[model samples]
Target: MSNLPLTSNKLLSTLSSSDYERLLPHLETTDLPLGQTLYEPNQPLNYAYFPLNAVISLVNILEGGQMVDATMIGNEGMVGVPLVLGTMQIPMSAVTQIAGQALRIEASIFRSTLQGNGALYSLMLRYVQVLMGQIAQNLACIRLHSAQERCCYLLAMMQDRVGSPELIITQEALSRVVGVRRAGVNEIVNTLGRAGLIGHQRGKITILDRAGLEAAGCQCYRTLRAEYGRLSRP
Candidate 1:
């Protein structure tokens, strides 16, 4: 019970006992390391991952090799959403942002199970809506908000997902996600550090004042939270 990977995930936990039992045999526990590429742009998805403790990023890589995160999936959601809709290809990159374990299922099995499982299908549909809202909010945030505000927004989101004050990620990766230069990210981090909102160390950041960080972010952060909360309700 305690060692079961899917048991702790919000999405999997909501499944009916019988449905979970049917899929349990197909679930394989796997470790996702930091910076691991789950899927590349326009590539076939071999499996669907339901992360138990990992965080995955959906990033859009530009022609210039720059990347910007479109959305994030964790214990609350499943990756390889295209498999459910009869498509195995995605234009964005799916990468492991946090090293942890997940229940990886064959794409074919997941798709077949989802087709006959009303509860699972409906839950995934709701998650898709919530994810769309987050992506839209992120677009607006990037276009209208300052770098500092965006940094705060990212930190607040990471804190919510990981349920921890300490996040282990590099400034280079942070810059890519926020669509900014490394120097720009450094400046924002320095500002947050000086304001006592966060403490920075090599390859890690510790949130010192979550409330203050949220206060520094734009309304997009709150809007995204409300949308996800509404869709996630049982």
Candidate 2:
């Protein structure tokens, strides 16, 4: 597991022994269903999730009801980060993109645990910094990169998080992640499949060649991975 955390979540693993011990009692193991919205725009958060295998996306909803993923959170990080920073509400929605396990804690209790300027507090602050950098890169990729390149980057990231070559993701989810239409997603995935980078059929996508997938993706995927690598290092 990542950094030998009690759970697979690297953020939990990176916490100091005392810090981990203090929160262990309150952390509950839960299963997140795919497409479940953890929190919505301006909605008060109740629990923070430290995903062990589950992948969550922080999606920003536009005025016309279009949704774009700001960034994806996996075992590398936690949802409900704003609570630790004294903000109770967020403009984006945190939705579960993959169904898997997570260690969940009540937001109030979690906030109380970070009362002082301690190791956990410092660690989360750094994690937030890494997350911000990742979101920035993702936004840039969406604007400057092709749909095929962005799709490759997103699939590669999701595969890394779930530790599986095969992914159970819907065309709807693909459209949301790539900020494209359903027809566009079909076109992009078809191209990737034809090139042998990935095999997409219905709701499941199988990575046929990991190296080839990365080769097809833009540099943003590698950049995000490097940024997350720095988070666990702290």
Candidate 3:
């Protein structure tokens, strides 16, 4: 297959023509399968990824083996922000939540591009603000929203990122993302399904009614979408 749609990433698509041409040769497409760790906390990041169709999950792993999701990076955002900030260490670990493609560049090379590339730097700055907003909104959503509402929001968000009704997630993983117990997640799942919002079996969940799912979710989903979707591109 041809390597088409390299600018499919919203962040990269905003690049100016000259900067894009200069950076093009250094970019490489890489496969990101489910559960693949892109970067771990306080570790060296080999590459920064600009997702094409994948959604990378950022999570905070507690000392006792518990994991809580921080935020997700889809085609609208790029990973490895810490590299541009003069650090390789971050508190959250980034892992692939949805299997798909991404454009990756070596961290060192990317930094070199920043040496006077105004557009890329400005874009990344805007991206950081977007990321911070997402994290804050998600924290509030988790604390204030009901489990069922949050479940609806999460499933809806995943559908948006994957651009398909099908979602590759188990109840266990979904529970982690929604910050709820597995049993609580099961109840939410049944509720949404009975309401004709979604369908699920094993490691897959499919959005059955997008409109209904949106109605079922909390306001945070809409907020995230507005901030991180169409308006997110620089």
Candidate 4:
């Protein structure tokens, strides 16, 4: 898996071979545990992490202490965007949403290397744009969609990030991410379960009806995919 194309990630893979090789030496493989905070709100970022299999969530904590995931990053993208934007501090908190591995690079090193006209810098910029589109769509979804629709969208997004039908998460944690109460989440979960769209046991959720889930989601999911496709540019 380590030897598989670093380009498996659209951002890294889009780089020219020579450019990728130059940065390859700096990429260090590391394990990411579930719920691990990569960066706290308003904190300085130390490194940029490119997931090989991990999923990271960018969450916003409101003044009232309410939390919701603004966007998600996975093997298709990288974390620590502040590094590329010429800042060390992040406004939102980043945390590992799933247990997996990633390629990490020091912020200083990445910034220095990315300077000047280079494929790496271009790829990073495009990825950031794609990420912004996802966040914007999610913001709208949360405002206009039903809790059940948002729940389906969230699960579909998670499945895409992890490339698995089963997700290991709890109602309490999910409530925080979806910006809903525990009871609301439980009610939706129970509805989906009874309809045979999903199966939940303990903290694990298994998607049983992919078609049904897609039907249940708002336009946000498709919007996210379209934006990524536009930025990825094959």
Off by over 4 Å in 1: 1-5
| Alpha-carbon TM-score of each model against the true structure | 0.91, 0.93, 0.93, 0.91
The TM-score of candidate 4 is 0.91
Per-residue C-alpha lDDT of model 3 across residues 6-108, encoded as one tens digit per residue: 8888788877789889889999998888999888888898888998888899999999978988988888888999977877778889999888889999999
Per-residue alpha-carbon lDDT of candidate 2 for residues 1-234, written as tens digits (9 for 90 to 100): 222244588778877777788889989888888989999899899998898888999988988998878888888898998997899899999989988778889999889888853788888899889888988888798889999899999999999887789888998898888889999999898888899888888889999999999998999998988887787565
TM-score of 2: 0.93
Q: Rate the local accuracy (lDDT) of all candidates.
A: 0.84, 0.86, 0.85, 0.83
Better of 1 and 3 by TM-score: 3
Candidate 1: C-alpha lDDT: 0.84
Candidate 4 segments whose C-alpha is farther than 4 A from its true place? 1-8, 63-65
- Of the pair 3 and 4, which is ahead by lDDT? 3
Top candidate on lDDT is 2
lDDT of 2 at 129: 92
| RMSD (CA, Å), each prediction | 2.3, 2.6, 1.9, 2.2
Model 3 scores a TM of 0.93
